[model samples]
Target: MPTATIAEDDDGIRLDRWFQRHTKDISFNIVSRWSKSGVVRLDGAKAGPGDRIAAGQTLTWPEELPVPVATRPTEKPREPLSEAQIEYMRAMVLHMDAHAIVINKPPGLATQGGTKQPTSVDAMLDALQFDAPSRPRLVHRLDKDTSGVLLLARNAKAAAFFSKEFAGREARKSYWALTVGVPKIAAGTIDAPIGKQPGTGGEKMQVDTEAGLKAKTRYRVIERAAGRAAWVEFLPLTGRTHQIRVHAAAIGHSLVGDGKYGGKESYLTGGISRKLHLHSRRLVIATPGGGTLDVKAELPPHMAESWQMLGFDLQLGDIEIVEPPPPPLKKRRLSSATSGNRRGERRSRGATDEPKRPPRKK
Candidate 1:
């Protein structure tokens, strides 16, 4: 991100107004959201959109922040979205409607921004608004480097509706990845619990079996390259952070190039790129109003390149889907009649007694 130093002439400008004046694409709504979401910082502290700026104050924001509200652009012609960027965003759309939008997001793009994150999908939502008044909101997240289908809610109604589905565990999301080693089993369920790793300043996670939230993932090895690596498909039953990656690592088949959990072996030799080899391949869920939303994303560039290099088939995960776990059984009590007994009778004395202690032997 680049830093903007407030000049003496532009002192006392509201953060929101500054964006409106300088940037052609950064709307007031985007400014407001960015401020409230902690993506805007003033002198290393979270800033509000209404905050006033003075001379020498430094404002840091995502490098991709749309055109300037700075003094240099107040009298200049408006800058339009570059043709290349417009085309890139247009090509990522898999499906779009009044209620939602499904996009095949690329790798290395953060779903949400943080202190060091200068650009992210959330920051670029303005390009997708089209006829809508407000920007589409993210329903869920994929990891920063894990590319593939990302769902967004186009309006507030859609946002609430999809959020409920995600909360209720209704979204059937499937992911594909290349892992370092082959699993002994071809397919299985991982029922371990996971939670934030202790004392890593809240930056990492672990298999906290002792006191962790429940997380389960069902995986099937779609294709394997012997012991060198395996291409696995995952259906996670829970929404814990880094659940799939951590579970795969715990099972001794860490994803290739995933160092946070995969360790040193994540880096492979022989011309394979050292990038996280995970992609959210598909999503099946109910739409906000009353229909189904099924979308699939193709392999991202790096993964596709790796697929070609390793001789792995890229079309194997086209229709990947897994059945949800069955519901738990209910307990029932038996009545006296059901137990082969009269209502008021007990077992016979002889039947209830030992066999006379074997005639007092020994």
Candidate 2:
């Protein structure tokens, strides 16, 4: 058996990737087989194939004969659908069409499942009973905390076409974010190169000029309140994981309620009305039908409430300023002359009137 201690830079890497780095002789196929047989334990428990291996996790891999392919199941059968699962299936159907389905994903739900839990966007789709033999497929993904427009393809051909469009950078996505402070500039572009942070649970993205992928974002200040938050529109030119969040934070204006990227103040003070103030507001894509497809999602309740509290009119693009209170006045120090002047009258009254004679002896 080979043992490895997870490092800080390895946070968001897959279990297979971790094993590949540590055990030079082990093949990915063998590791996959071991994962299926429950030979690899992450943090003292069985880990799945897609589980992100974070730092501080203890990984143990057994070195043994390859498990028989016949013995190992190809894929686990879907579990019995629960009431909640059924409801999700029903909701998914509402978004279905001939070619694609668009979903209004809520916040706090992961697009894909990890080792510990199975309730994810993909799992739910797997459990769904479609009339045809084909299974639903994800065309794109959203962050766990960001709620809004998500697209899925119904068939393999459709999935392939959409994948091509995404890879070719033909898809256009827009987002609405409430930031902590008003940006000085009204409209500008953030041209930054984004690269994944090594070993930090794989959750962090950093700005790298030399080696990072090129990312471009066009931002316009929709509304700004002096000394408070601002509502902004974002258009990402390239899709890098957490690209928008990291770029915004790099400019010293983190999305409101984004705790991981220095958004604690906005979160705690209820600056923007939600746990995370960013939302996927709109998506425009070149449809398979030779036309454009535009979809928009309404603002979530939390974001709406916060906007109201800050006296913002989304439709009109107006905002009210609630400036922070001014700092207290500092006490002024008195000079030595001023202090002596105040006591000068008393000292003069006690002055002697007689003239003094010169001293003869020293």
User: Model 1: per-residue lDDT, tens digit, 1-362?
Assistant: 76788764345667776666666677778767878788888888888878877668888877776535444454634245566766777789999988888999999888998898957787777788788765688989998999999999886557767888999999999998999977666666677788888888767888887888998887777777767988888889899999999888877788998999987889999989899999999999999568999999999988998888888766565543334453344532344321433111122211321111112346
Where does candidate 2 stray beyond 4 Å?
1-73, 92-94, 127-130, 268-274, 316-362
Which prediction has the highest lDDT against the true structure? 1
Ten contiguous residues minimizing lDDT sum, candidate 1: 349-358
Record all residue pairs in model 1 with backbone atoms less than 3 Å apart, i.e. clashing.
22-68, 22-69, 23-67, 23-68, 23-69
Best model number under TM-score:
1
Residue-level lDDT tens digits of model 2 in 1-362: 65667765355567766555544455678767777899988877988756777768887777473322321233577676788776865563335566677777777778988985467788888554366345668888898889888887765556766888888888888888888886655455677788878788777988878788988776667766655778877778789999788877766778988877865555636444548877887777776667676777777788888888878667643222123343354643333421322111111111222212234667
Model 1 residue runs over 4 Å out of place are 1-84, 319-362
Q: Where's the lowest-lDDT run of ten residues in candidate 2?
A: 342-351
